[model samples]
Target: MDGLMPPPARPRPAFTDEELRTLVRPDRVHRSLYTDPGIFDLEMERLFGRAWIFVGHASQVPNPHDYITTRIGREPVIMTRDAKGAIHVLSNRCAHRGVSVCATDSGNTRHFKCPYHGWTYRSDGTLASLPQRRSYPHDRAEIESWMSLARAARVDEYRGFVFASLTEEGPDLETYLNGIRHSIDDLVDRAPDGEVAFVGGCSRYIIRANWKLQIDNGVDLHHATYTHVSTLDDDGRQFSRHGGGPRIMVDGKKSIDWEPFGVVGFPYGHGYQGRPPVETLPSGPVYEEYVRRLEARHGVDRTRQILNYDRFNSVIWPSMTFQAFGQHIRVVRPISVDRTEINVFPVALKGAPEAYNTGAIRSLAATHSAASMIQTDDIEVFERAQAGLQSGAHDWVLFAGHPGSEEPWHEGGWRGQGTSEFVSRIQYAENWISFLCGGNGNERG
Candidate 1:
């Protein structure tokens, strides 16, 4: 009676780390990873909770009092630049009634006041006042804690990009980026002054598929050869028939029957496809003008490196997608197990000619926008993949497409053909497994 055996320990969790390990295999992944509602909630806790999630770029809130509302996992938050030019990410909920403190899509505001109650907070999220303060007990420490907006555990900026962590500890932004940072650097470096700016507006589309499918497909070129084949014009069709459309290659080798693309993979599922031959991009009225500016600022050789250097799609695992070639960026937001929202932002190179920026914008319009000639068809394929995955006809989605390559690490991380399962496999190994197990990122495949 004294010990009572403590009735054994109660298992607080409904699932365990062992169960999540079962969701992945060497060359295949279980379908539940795409369709399970419970798993989605767990990911919100584990994946988004611990990772350094991309909140917004510094340009989004450039001026004092400028702010934009967004979410980290399911937590509603606001990213605001204060009068002193420091950026802060504060929970959007009012401390009193749990109502949104600021409700417009985005704008400049000196302070936030809850509509439900009179609680007010400064731009830095410090509580200014609340109605009838005399009615409450004056415990200074307790009141200070309650009045202040809850902030993210950690916030850091890299190259004007801002990221926040819900958990207190993790690698800083630079470490999380690793090889993938080069893709972002190159994107802004292509600008004549070594900088780029968002064009102030973005196109958004609702994708009816899992968010993972969209990110994986962002770095995937094989699907474009099939899914967007219909959008090809007569000349475009001819080019496709000869295997000369959009492509991802490494070491000049991208043949289905041949060795796969030479790509780079890094920790946290971030990587880039082979650099495209941007030098061969069709010359235009503005092409010569853009080249002159680049050469003027960076010299001929550096400009050549910039022009010929092409990264088709640089994927930042979980959601963000960067494309150096298109001068466009994508942020994928997961709404549910089957729904994802993709925001596409068109960017411009600073100190470059007007014609150059306009051409890149036009190129994006024709191929990547909502009104894009090809994406409508591609969206259908994404939905179809979702429908098929939900059928449960196959327990695993196969990534076994690479021809013949070594299974071990290549150049520090696992890498192989453009279609190699190694990319996804290592993502699961280095990032997913460690994330699911709540480890310190030391776990390896």
Candidate 2:
């Protein structure tokens, strides 16, 4: 039996051209995108289905027979290192009786034994053994081709991060990643040893808001000063009331002005916010050392550009978001129209001083953790936004901040200054195209 199912009929267009144009004003977005279950389902099929959604890292399954299970879109997938050292991504369902082959989050096993029955499979997803050999008259050859575990249509890895797509056709991983590849490069390049390991346990939390809201907020720098004020205040520093006034610094230097940070929006929904280093100690020493090492390998000016580069958050089109300095990676898993599960992982510099990873974990936990003062406030606000969207008072929200104002494209894409919602606008633009065109043609705006 073919496992592929026909694409479901398209739902009524969630927003018309005029309505979407109004919804995503230069500075705001429509409220319906957050509350509408119909739009959310379309997103899973169009955006999530085509995008290179992050699977677990290769280091998570370093040894042969080691497996890590994760979700891609709504499908449960198993990523494993086979005896040949090749990584395979396959559906977790058993071919024999449609039972799940593996149930644990992760583990090492020579073969997968289906819990419902005695059917077993090798680490490579091939049929290994069944309970009775002669139960069926026409057995081994016929069963072999039919019983292998179902595999993802395509699987690819970049810088140790694994990704799988449900569709067999589309842009390859690199093309699809577009300009966002720099984020991955920066992640490894910043490591003293030019490599990173997935270290520390994952920190996960459920947010009661649409997944896109979380993504938009990740690149929204305007909130740092206001929403995160309590966090900074807890450290005994006060933000300047005046825009340019002197303020207490985390590292005894000038505080970041927030306005200088720029936002870049890419072709797909991918984008990033540029941030100057918070006046701090460790950055100078660590960055200088990293640059010197990079200079030795790639020479001077190039090393300067790579090491001294500033980026606040690097967001992948649909799910993953990276903060290279903080060594933080967040995976957004949409559970429903208004519910999202976010998993945060810390990257360890393979051969660098332990203090680097420790400091990163500490800072990440302090800022983004469930107990974080800043994150808690942001969560409450997002939840309130969701609740408000349920009201019929407003048909749309607006994204028109700084209308007709967008920066020129530099290397990867166009950049927008801080306080601009260009990032949010670009995201909705992509959403409009993907859903309306079914991941094909351009969207009419």
Best-performing candidate as measured by TM-score: 1
Residue range 265-298, candidate 2, lDDT tens digits? 7766677888643544244565456456667766
**Weakest 10 consecutive residues of candidate 2 by summed lDDT:** 239-248
Backbone clashes in model 1, listed as residue pairs: 250-262, 261-418
For model 2 the local lDDT of residue 90 reads 77
Q: Ten residues in a row with the worst lDDT in model 1? A: 1-10
TM-score against native, each model: 0.88, 0.85
- lDDT of model 2, residue 378: 78
Clashes of 1: 2
User: What local distance difference test score does each model get?
Assistant: 0.71, 0.72
